[model samples]
Target: MTGFDPDWWCDGAALRGREYLSISRDGVELARAELDPQSTDVDEYTGLDLPATVVKIEFFEVRKQLRGRGVGRWAVAALIQHYEGPWFTVAAVTAAGFWTSIGWTEARHAARPCSSTARYLFNANALPSLDHGSDL
Candidate 1:
């Protein structure tokens, strides 16, 4: 998989509250997502004065014509890495397998759902202490 250009994601994410990102492979756009780049001085995990990055995928969709070809997984995983830590998404019940297959843990046990759909999280670097945001 082509690595995400780090220089691109953070700049756009910091410029506004949420950023629109699309994943394309072989020049064809396969997926798109809405990401919230939470840039803060204090880390949510440690409460230390350090740079912390938390990205939330408010919406994600794979092109209807191409559903199960690993595009969605790659797109999501890339965003998770590109954004760097604690990625959250509101996912449909039917898509639970896809999320879990990619190592995202269900948030019902870790955090309460604040939305109609279920929530999933991937906080690779730290011990999770989840706080669900009503907006997501």
Candidate 2:
């Protein structure tokens, strides 16, 4: 699982102050993501409070043909290393497993359990984040 070598390129803080990210391996693009610091007072979808500490993930995707490989793992690991606690994202309900499997804890409460999107958080693992590919 440790073999995927990811190179990240980030630029342009124009998308609502979010930065675009691209991850590649040996010149081949493997994944893409967008990150923004949450500035709003509350989440419109779930009405959850948004604090300055939350870093919102605007987008995340791995190439279709590279789904099951370690590409996603490496990308997520890289992100955790670059950010502080805690990460926040509104994800499709179906993809909840991926978040949980990677040590993300759900932030959705019973009051908003059936919302169209689910919220998840990753707190940089107390400091170490992911250890190579094994933890990812």
Candidate 3:
């Protein structure tokens, strides 16, 4: 898969508080991810005291044609590598397995809602301790 090039993606627009990444093949956009630094959706959903630097993935989508072709996985992995920090997103029911397959673990406080929040801690230092035995 072709990797993301920040300079190529963010060249024209001056991204202030948000960052965007797009995955494409042969000039066609296959998937996209948007990060919002100010979002507290994760904390709101999970009721956890996440650090302020933890950004939320405001939006993430893969083209229908490319759904199971590893495009989304590659895009998310690239995002984690690029940002190198804590990232979280509220995932739709169809996407929970995808997130888990990509190494994201559901938050300890997360319920098995049809749509629930999931998190990826790229930096091990940012991972919080949780009591696995506790019920959400």
RMSD of each predicted structure: 10.8, 6.7, 9.3
Cα lDDT tens digits for candidate 1, 1-136:
3244343444444445878888877798787777677733222322222235546666677776778887787777667656656544444466778888877766542132344455566664552322332111
Ranked by lDDT, the better of candidates 1 and 2 is 2
What's the lDDT for all of these models?
0.59, 0.63, 0.59
Clashes of each: 0, 0, 0
Give the candidates in order of TM-score, highest first.
Answer: 2, 1, 3
Q: Pick the candidate with the highest TM-score.
A: 2
Worst 10 residues of 1 by lDDT: 41-50
Give me the candidate number with maximum lDDT. 2
Off by over 4 Å in 1: 1-16, 39-53, 86-94, 109-117, 126-136
* Residue 61's lDDT in candidate 3: 79
TM-score of 3: 0.57
**Stretches of candidate 3 above 4 Å error?**
1-16, 42-49, 91-93, 110-136
**Per-residue alpha-carbon lDDT of model 3 for 1-136, expressed as tens digits?**
3344343345567467777777666898887777775665544335455665565676677776667887787777556555555555544445667767876666654464444344443332343532232222
